[model samples]
Target: MIETAILTPLEEELFALVNALEQFGFKKHKSLLGSLEIFEFHELNLLLALGGHGKTQFGVQSQYLLCQLPQVELLICAGAAGALSNELEIGDIVAATATVEHDYNLKFVNRPLPRFTGTPQVIDTLKQLPRTEWDFRLHFGLIASGDEDVVTVERGQELAYLTGCVAVAWEGVGGARSSQFAQKQYVELRGITDTANHCAAADFEVNLASAMFNLAKLIVRWQAAKDYCAV
Candidate 1:
């Protein structure tokens, strides 16, 4: 029986991970969405969706597709994010404690304050993983999500101050919202691919591969722990 679904924003983020899974007996199944990859691991069914970048695409795909996969007990959004905090370096991972839509607001009507928290049981499960011998550090904190790519030091600082988020991404908030609406346990794991600054693009291009691969490794380790099955 399939119980988990994973969503990634781009193929670059998931390609290496998908290839690695094939060695562990995960076979792909054809999916409705042209780029969607459905894999089976033992009795577990996993759906990997390519949501593209930005909140609109992510939210639409997540809500529409999750409804089709009613067997999913846990939904995870894993990908790369820009580091908003100076404490984070390239390849560091942050398991989002909560995701906030930093761009959501109604001028003169509402302020941008909506946040979606990770499911407590799932967060606990992630916390129990062995940390010894890990190459990069793992952090748990707020992740700010918005439509715009943060590429300036000033903007990054402003966002970090406003949301108190250590990382920023395009899809986390949207994915979290969709999972929440489906009443499914949700978690987001993001690897730092760049520091949000003038050099963000070059930094991301250089570090994205490692960051994504690390995320895949984390997911594999989490699955091996078998903690998610209890959720």
Candidate 2:
């Protein structure tokens, strides 16, 4: 069984993906968390939840879902992100090999870097999937996560230099940390929605829908190929 979490309810890509799966007999359920929405794909033993936005919410909801759905064998955190690398373009997809909390720091003492590497088995599984023909490219790399949206090119460059990350987002590291603590297999896939610049908001607005849709499509494709129903 697989458990998937996204950050927001208003995300059209997620909404479309869930609705499409519903036609295949997936059932929606009410969740205990106010910001969360639950959907079950009985045939595939898949559970989907909306974890709300931000790092804290993602971490809390990931733990809650993991505890509540102990039967799930894998956890996927999928959403949109800003490209930190010049190689990345809007609407491209990134399957994170590792995640780092770039905004985390100690007040005065030197703290170990907050980096979480995803389960290798899960990462390998994703890497082995057959590539589908799509307009956007798929990349495997590190992703930096933080509470603030990176808006300047210089800031983006600094983060990439620090973490060697190709993209940045608000919640992937939270989910990664939660999954690590639970000892659950986890993977994160982010679709690029902007280039992290002065024009980030405008670029994000233009690319968000397409990026989200593509991410959902990739998930659905992987589930189908794995014959999730039988597993």
TM-score of each: 0.90, 0.85
List ranges where model 1 is wrong by over 4 Å: 23-35, 43-45, 110-112, 227-231
lDDT of each: 0.81, 0.75
- lDDT, candidate 1, residue 171? 91
Clashing pairs in 1: 2-45
lDDT of 2 by residue, 110-174 (tens): 88668888778767766777776777788999999888879998999999998899999888877
Using lDDT, give the best candidate's number. 1
Off by over 4 Å in 2: 1-13, 19-35, 228-231
Tell me the tens digit of each residue's lDDT in model 1 across 85-189.
Answer: 888988899999999889887678855589999988878878889978678888999999888889999999999999999999999878888898899888889
Q: Residue 199 in candidate 2 has what lDDT?
A: 88
Query: Which window of 10 residues has the lowest lDDT sum in candidate 2?
Result: 1-10
